[model samples]
Target: MSNIIGIGGSIHDFASCLLIDKQMNAIEDERITRVRHAINSSNPCQPSLQYCLNWAGLQLEDIDTIIANDDLLQVIDPHVYPDIVLVNHHLTHAYSTFFTSPFEEAAILVLDGAGSKLSGTNGDIRETTTYAYGNKNDVTVINRVFGDLKGKNYVTKSETLMSNSIGEFYRAIAENLELGWLVGPGKVMGLSSYGASFGDDRFISEMMSCIKLLPEGQFKININGEKGLIDKFFQIRQNYHKKEDPFRIDAAIAHAGQVVLEKVLFHTLDYLSTKIQTKNLCLAGGVALNSLVNGKIPFLTKFKNVHVFFAPGDSGTAIGASIWGYLNNSNQTDDLIRFHSGPFLGRPYSSDEIVTALNSIGLTYTQPVDLYHQVAHLLSRGRTVAWYQGSSEFGPRALGNRSILADPRNSLMRDHINSNIKHREWFRPLAPAVLDSTTAVYFDAHCLSHWMQFVWHVRKKFHKILPSITHVDGGARVQSVSKDENPSFYTLLENFQQITGIPILLNTSFNIKGEPIVETPYEAIHAFLESQIDVLVLGEFLVVKKFDLTFKSPI
Candidate 1:
């Protein structure tokens, strides 16, 4: 019974995870504190580790090996006791993707804002390392080696390093757009849907010009140096807003341009495929979160299979770090195959705890055995419900367990949820949690996205029907809920289907903008009172906040 603990603390999203004998037992992040991009903070991991250990019914002493995602031995102050094993950030990211993917062999891609650099006497350089574990029925190994993309093997090796990057460009574009300063690339993706084509020739020329101006490798131009670039790219938006009929022509053009860049990525992979000759492709890093790029893999790449770990961002480094530690310390062949699907490795709540929380708040509620029917009725009545159950998820997504539920039939619900409930940007679209079996009926994608990590085009026939969750580009980030993946969530969808003839529900993270997903019932109640959310369901207890009698809305 090997017990390994993983800890990550780099720029933002400090996190930790525990795996017992290769089975993921627990995971959590620091962002839950409502502190945006909290990194290496003391409050994040101490309690999280305690909670994880408790969930596994073990103590800290039970842990055989501790894996530190970042180089804590070097960065952290002395006196911190764990004295963890160190794992390279990129290797962990690669392992997290490769280990979790369903495919036996795949091309792995890891992209991030930036990774730690190992200083060579020659100069600063980017590295590309690959590790292969021997085949276990559940897990297979292809190769394991590490090399610098620069220096001796420069040309052939350079491809390995360049292939992993592309994210820096997106980040620069995001900064130029005046979106949120840190990690706002996702906003650029959302905004791209509004752009229009400016003719293929002109578009390609402009994009190529921009790429050419970019500093080579990791050398990024200062934000001030790139102001002119921003002005040029955004000219279309300024012009469009002045027109009588405003359209997202610029956005559409940008979207098309991004697609073209993604093709470059595919081309790079095609080149790599000639040597690796593996059908499976594994991707990690923040860039791997781009569902559009991920969705395009099957059609664009030479590899027949592609797999991306759920938390491909920096937060996932904790898990990757730990796994690397285990493999290295055990000095055993990488025989582990299957990883547990439940990212709900966070703290759990007991019924007594729920009861205590309700009583402390002086809330009136009834425990219902038929939770599905009860919650479905509230949603059907046009009430937004906060659903909290079991352990919290590991990744940024709330999944079903810690999600806010709403009826998708109402178009106004989208605006209401965004402005009044979630208080997020209007352009951001909500996600859909649909019964896994019915995904094919409504979406164009064939994969089952239990993690809500992929975007699929909503069938034209269902666009209007599910408008609240569908993006302007007719795509929806979808979580296909299965009984095997989450039984309670699955049953809720089943019951909702029985009542409304729709197997899908509008699912968004159970938090307002600028806050992490609610980790406790008290937090859920506080969010409910502060926001437009009408109903709160934690475990079996359902509480409805009493709003001002004069408050009224179409939703």
Candidate 2:
């Protein structure tokens, strides 16, 4: 059996993937290091690499080939390791989504803040956006856009008419707004819905004029130099913070940036539809994490079948590179590289490990006869639960395996969790974990979002009943649970349906802000105790707080 390992090494989001024959396992360094993005030295993700090896009972010497980015050779000697193959950043991103998808052929679109740096006529630039098409095992790039750095200003390369970059535009706005660098884009996306409430069109118009759709599925950002229009809005927000509408300017800027991004994506997808005959579309890179834009692609564009992998960001490049290596080494063309299983590709904790962790923490627990029934009843009665089961998910989302589940019927549940448990922005929305069979009953479209990659509008009739899960705009980042893939989560959903007449529950990542998702049983227990979670489910065992820690909302 051939063992291929893919390494995604950078200053941030370092990860490793192991493809043994057809089976695949992947994990980000952030999950093991307990850092948001695992900012580290230029090397392979050691902790993640160890985890993958331990999961499969293998060692470094056993790996037949190591596929990684060219940037990894900066710190270490290349001759010390096994046969190493270097691949480009955007090509790996393209392969991560397209190869994992069920589509035989699909148009691939990869858009990120920045990719591998290359020397240009003016200066060094990084790849920003790439369009490619994948047929069988071959992925061919059709067009590309580069983000050129001029002093402190980021812009498209000299070839494009617009000075700015489509990939970097939203990040620029987010940074100017002081939303932070690591997790700003998501906050900006969440803050967008409130922009229209202030009745301000100036920011929107100004932002729109900066971005324009170009030919050949390309778009450009043409903002002013250095401290441009985004900085102007930031200055405006400083004065607005003292007033009642503290987030008025911030919201407007976010909304404007979001509008431009969606427009560009829609235009690009339409162009791709005209170029490619297949109805399938695969999206990757950090920008693909925007569920709002991803949701609109299926309905707004000509592509009817859209596939966005679980780990579509930098973390997923490891899987992609590994797949490329695996396919190249194997002589069999009929053998397809795919995640035939699901996204729970991390190392799973055994029952003994869970028990040992509980013992070490001195936490009392009980294994109920019907664990799903008891947990579902607790949720029905308005108790927040930290559910830890099986292996951790391979993406930013916590899909059932490592999630905090709550009752969606409670209108105040969202605010309570935001302020108390998550310690995040109040405007940020929570997601819904619904039974796959009952998705059509509540949501407008019967889209099967198993990976929480799409946002669907909640049906008007169930809006009031499921207030906590639905966003302010009546849309929800939904994860439809299936019995075949996740039996425990599906059983819990079934039990929840029997208790509350709704097969839905509020779900979010099982971690507070500034930390990555909990990986080990120890981290899970620690997170449960640190927060106000009423029940902690570690496999079949249930643990609750010894004292009366009733949730009193600060809001």
Candidate 3:
């Protein structure tokens, strides 16, 4: 058996994964550091690499191969390691999709910022990369669009980019709005729903002038596109300021950008569909994390099926690279090995760690006779609890395993969680972990969304009761929890449902604002003790502060 480790990410969402044949163990660097997208790059740190090795129950000498998603990322040690495989940035993103997806043969599309530095003049920025066909055995690349973006000294003074990159356009929009480039499109998506749609508002459509469409579906952004959009926003700021609502202009701009993103992508998909008859698609890259845009693809385009792997952002490339390394070498790529146990691949804490942390605070706790049932009982009483169970998830999302959950019916919980708990924007919405079978009853979910990567509309009737889980636009980032995938987490939900009529919970990542999702039992306890977070559920033991309601607002 060979031990293959894959590392990915440069600027943000860094992760490492160890794949022993079909079995996989992975962890994101942010989890260990407790920073939302740690900045240290140019070399892989010991904690993350060692975590991968420890997950595989291996030593330094036990590793047989090291695979980095980007060769020029300067993260992996080239000379210190003998057997090293460096896959291209977009290629690894492609592998993450085809291999993780159920389809044996599928079309792959990748969209992101310039993943790697540009090489040619015509292909200035690599915005869209596509793998025409893929099977369990191999993926064939018929189109490569990522190597087009010119960064650094790669382009001439006159040439800014190979093509008008939707990613760069979106980046400009996000950066201009004050959300850092590293922050994904989530905040924009949240804000977009609060504004008027193009058809409903002439002002929103007027903002689309910057994006220019050319012959044969080719497009370019005028030099004035980014500046014009921002300038127009500021010019009209006085009008919005005259109004009571502070977010009026911000929401309008977000709505305009969202409209541009969705429409342009829909047109691109239609154009591509005309060229290729294949209906199955596997999508990857940072842009794939845009659930607002992703949710519309199946409906807007001719494609019948679209598969986007969990951790589609750069963090997932580590798993993709390792999978590529093993399968490419063995030539058994066609028969893709499914990464079972889901993406909760971080290191598990032993019972010893849990007990030690609990004892440190002199906190009294009791292991319930039935952990799931008792946890459900606590939730039934409207107790918001930090639940830490299995290995932490390896992405921006905190799927049940590392989540803070409360009663979905409690509408006030949203504001409470936002202002007192999460310390994020008051406008940001929460998500729901619904029973897989009952997902359609509450959401207009067309397919099974195991990961919260798709936006599903909350049913009209449930909107009033499930206000915390439902966004202002009626969309809920839905995660349909399957019993087979995570039995323990599913059981907790089942217990909660048994106690309450609703199966959904107001779920968010278990951490204070600006912190990464809690990784270790120690971190979970640390967060629990520090924040207004009501209770700490680490493994079987649940600890609560004596004066649970006595904390000051984190906001």
Candidate 4:
């Protein structure tokens, strides 16, 4: 009867997971504290740990173990932890996804900024892209790739050779392009689609010179670390910047970086596939969040099967570390995927609780004749609704339960949400939740992506119909929802389709710009009050705050 609690904090996306016997409860610190990435905060994971303990009906003493992914555990109070295991940072990322993957024995790919040091010291940094072979309870490393997560949170020339550190290259390019840190990659992914697909006369030469794949299947770079690559990138970008359209330069830069990243990853995966000879591949870490690169792996390599979890970054390491501890310590025979369950891993309130919350918020509410139909009707009329139902989601992306849903067909809906509610960057692409049956007809995703993890091409015909969700390059990261997985969300989509003749809904997370998705009924109501959305659905309750709505989108 070992109750394991896993904590991952510091820098960004802090989280805690409680694995009690057979059930697993996990939550991100951003959701509870209403912060963006849960960065620069004191006492980072205490509130999240407290919530996990309360939900599991256990206390500190009842817990058998707590695991952190770093030797220097970035904890609020290390004294509270009597005996916490400092698992290797990369191992946590690796086992977290591979152990929970559907594959019995798969090729594991763990690529983040810089993995933990092998010696856990000042200068000892582990490999960045680590390939492993795993079966049942044992996951063994088979190959290592070029890169480092040691210096300056990324591989710097001071620490390692300026080889194929893909994460650092992307981050640096984005920062020089004025996107700042890792925030611009998603936007650039969308932007790259709009650029010429790396023409012969394009900036591909410079990018290749900076990041080259050798004949021996190694990625090398001649550019000096840090400022050297940035200088060349800015110089090459200046050619496009001279164009009348300001976006031309930025789009070209994004396209160049994406081209280099794709080439390096393809080479790496191909090399791993040959060595491991496995049909299944498991991907984890911050770099795993790149859906564009992920979609191409199967096409370029021998691995036909690929598995990725929603929270593959630092935040997900919490659950991964806990699950790893479970497999290692208990009699469990790798049943993580079976017991993994859905991502709605937070609090689920009852109808009575919803009523009480609505009353407390001083809002006029009613349990409509059909909650799905009512919300569907609002979406049909191009009204945005904050949908907070069932339990909160565990990852950064909001699936269906906690979402701000709108009509994807509305050309203005994207701008409407941006200016009115989210206040997000113009380049922040929107996502859609389509009926699983209709996924292929609308998107050429090549596989099912219910987690909004892969970018699927919106068919030519459906492009105009789903403008709000469609990226400039005609691809969108989509969630294909089926009735069995989520009945209410599926039904809402069905009803909206019956009315608007479209089965898709623009599903952005349910929150404002600088905050995480709403986690509770009260938080949903609070977001509704702060934004200009028309409605808020908390379970069976449909609430409308008595406030004047005068703000309008400039679009």
Clashes per model (N, Cα, C within 3 A):
23, 0, 14, 1
The predicted structure with the larger lDDT, 1 or 3, is 3
Using lDDT as the measure, name the better of candidate 3 and candidate 4. Answer: 4
> What is candidate 4's lDDT per residue for 265-301, written digit by digit as tens?
8887878877787899988887788888887777768
The count of backbone overlaps in candidate 1 is 23
Runs off by more than 4 Å, candidate 3: 71-77, 120-128, 146-163, 197-203, 214-217, 222-245, 332-341, 547-555
Q: Pick the candidate with the highest TM-score.
A: 2
lDDT score, candidate 4: 0.76
Q: Please provide, for model 1 over 319-400, each residue's C-alpha lDDT reduced to its tens digit, 9 standing for 90 to 100.
A: 8777666666665555555465657767778889988888888888887788789888777767788999987888778888
Q: Candidate 1's error at 145, in angstroms?
A: 15
Which regions in candidate 1 have their CA more than 4 angstroms from the true location?
39-44, 54-61, 70-75, 78-81, 121-164, 196-204, 212-257, 330-336, 546-555
Tens digit of per-residue lDDT, candidate 3, span 178-239: 66566736788887888753233434566567666554445554322234444455445556
Candidate 3 matches the true fold with a TM-score of: 0.90
- Higher-lDDT candidate among 2 and 4? 2
Q: Which residue pairs in candidate 2 collide?
A: none
Where does candidate 1 have its weakest 10-residue lDDT segment? 215-224
Can you give the TM-score per candidate against the true fold? Answer: 0.84, 0.93, 0.90, 0.90
Lowest summed lDDT across 10 adjacent residues in model 2 is found at 153-162
The RMSD (Cα, Å) of candidate 1 is: 6.0
**Residue pairs of candidate 4 with colliding backbone atoms:** 114-149
Candidate 2 has an lDDT of 0.81
